[model samples]
Target: MELRQMRYFVGVAEELHFGRAAERLYISTPTLSQQIKQLEREVGTTLLIRHSRGVELTPAGQVFLARARETIQAAGLALKDTRRAAGLDEPVLRLGLLNGVPGWLPAALEQLAADRYPSSTVTLAAGTTVDQVRMLSSGEIDLGLVRTPLTLPVATTSEHLADEELGVLLAATHPLAERTELTLDDLAGLELIWIQRAAAPEFYDDALKRLGDQIRLSDISMSHSQLHSALRVRRGAISLGSCRAATPDVVWRPITGRPLVAKYAAIWRTDSHNPVLRSMTVSPGLTAVRQQVVAD
Candidate 1:
């Protein structure tokens, strides 16, 4: 059906009263009723049971209501994106960031502001790579900093940001905590804390390939904070994370020979006309940060 039909259905479904729905939609009750009837005809099934007092949704109505709400939300987002692209909206850049973004991202953003789009304001949202990618696709965010080895959607593009060496996060009291550096062989007998694969499939797979056969794996589902808490309490347990993710209570030591690295990329929609996005993507600061990481 049409977007207008979906909006009308959602209004009526939520209100359950023709008069109230019409009032909410800024239309007359007769018009709302006529549109609902048209929607029912198009669906070839009864959606609502009319009564003198109020309305009740039929089983088909319940299903249609859910889909109709989704359609309306999607349409609203599409319209907003279009307006923003056409420069009809305020210059606000919504940026999505995966956990543990590198230390240089803020500097890069500052460089972007000074060099281009000085009037633009940026808001940041934190999520995993998968969540960031989904947000980018749905027009919830204009740009994303996500872990690499991800497959971008057809409408999106990405550029390499930086690559960070994987480091061991261990309890302060652990035996290996005294070492300045660790090797893959040193991690063989330790219990490894595993991150969920669905969060970043490529990173997960690479982690498994690197440690699955050598280390004793512990599959515990936890967020970044929870993982840090677990590390503080569990003596022999360790996790592989970016060197830049070091916290005060844990010992973060770079892996020695055969280094493991996590790559990051800046992702954005191809259709976005946000000039700030282009500036962020091509910032010299990012290139300098990449070079510094490589030098380290």
Candidate 2:
């Protein structure tokens, strides 16, 4: 139910075709479809009807479309007024972010972005890699700290930053937690953490297939905080991840032979002219991750 979701819906409602709407919005068709589904969930009704010929707005969609447009207009007016009153016309380096970034990164980014261009300020918004891609395409963010590998829209590009072994996560008290390394057979009867597929359909499907080819996952449990809780309380609860979240009760372990790896990259619009944005490396996301891996 974010303004971004509303914006996505408006695009589709106008074009009556997901592909055409996606092109107009600079986002992939799948991403646009996912957002519309989410918006429908929040609104408690189906907004669009899809069939062989084309897409049609449901009765609810027709009503919501009018309101959605009005909301966008009102929001635009509010933003313009606020910007004028605040004299915030100065250049800004807006960066979309993901989880597992180092704790002390934001303060460093503020100074780094400021140093890169004249009178430029840095701003950050947290989202999944899929969300970052959408924000980047729509000009809501100038750059992003995102997980890879993903397809870049024609208007954007990415620079590879770092790679991490897709390793094990479990409670320190778990029987196998003491192992320095793990083999695929070690996960024979273990359950894994759940990832929200709707957030990033491409990555979710690819990653799970990659893992499944090597290991036999019994089932998926909860995610995020709930994931930490399961891993902390149940010795059988296990997951593979590259993120180094500060879960004191949980531990990360390298998989034997490194069957899979996760990657991170900095993404930005190819035609961007913002000096600070052009120079961004997502510094803190990398240095510290590499440092930690080396230390381990």
Candidate 3:
């Protein structure tokens, strides 16, 4: 009926001798004997045949003993996970981030990761959100910095950390490149050059869905390479990317009406059994990161 009762039952079942089982449990022989009798009564079946030489399990006892062992093991694991989440007893935190996490976030992230995990090591990574998501799902990493509109399944818990606007990258000589702002309709029929699914699947997929069927999709050679080949070849070619990705070689223009904003989120798989990973905290750091972006 209770975990302690199952534990005592298992101990006595394994030892067979009342004195030995009590010694193993650090309880008196009489206490162990009484508890075993109580357990048998509670189960409505006789658990053991007691004799002066030794104890032997009844048919009911054997079946219940096996199940009791499993229940105790499962309960122990659940307690371990709970303590780990509370940072009472946990391993290191494996953290992953997008390649271009804002500069202002490092100190805050370091503080939180370090303060809460003095005995733990926090490993940080820089990569596409899709790669981080894959790592989290595969148990390669515990946490990820993701950019949304994410289409990943509901099994992942996503916390909105910041908003990164999607901008059009163009050469300085291009018509709208010099303009600080451009509207959604401004890009209606333009020859667009963008990263293919290989460059970054989630980003590319979300971009395609937002841009719709009216625009043509072109391919870039490298899956990991950030360079957009089409944008490089032609002066008028354009690509959609995060504002944080804006570089010196390319000027960014706002997408007038749409003002597309990509949300940066902390994502972790909900189904993960890793206790240390499930204990991660994503609080004030997210707010600080968002504020930094706003202040900038």
Candidate 2 residue-wise lDDT, 211-274, digit = tens: 6654545455454446676666666778766546426677888777536776666688878766
| Each model's lDDT | 0.79, 0.72, 0.70
Q: Model 1, range 60-138, lDDT digits (tens) per residue?
A: 9999998887787688788777787777866677878677667576456555655667788888878999999988987
Candidate 1, run of 10 with poorest lDDT: 106-115
> Residue 283 in model 2: shift from native, Å?
15
- Residues 71-136 of candidate 3 have per-residue lDDT tens digits of 886786688678867877656666786766665554455555666555667777667777787777
Clashes by residue pair, model 1? none
**Which clashing pairs does model 2 show?**
none
Query: What does candidate 1 score on TM?
Result: 0.68
Give candidate 1 misplaced runs (Cα > 4 Å).
Answer: 1-87, 279-296
- Residue ranges of candidate 3 with Cα displaced over 4 Å: 1-90, 100-108, 151-155, 198-203, 212-214, 221-225, 228-230, 271-279, 282-296
Cα displacement (angstroms), candidate 2, residue 218, comes to 5.7
Cα error of candidate 3 at position 60, Å: 56
Residue 143's lDDT within candidate 1 is: 80
Give the least accurate 10-residue stretch of model 3, judged by summed lDDT.
218-227
- TM-score-sorted candidate list, best first: 1, 2, 3
Task: Tell me the TM-score of each prediction against the true structure.
Answer: 0.68, 0.61, 0.57
Q: Please give the clash total of every predicted structure, in order.
A: 0, 0, 2
Cα-based lDDT at residue 13, candidate 3: 88
TM-score, predicted candidate 2 vs. hidden true structure: 0.61
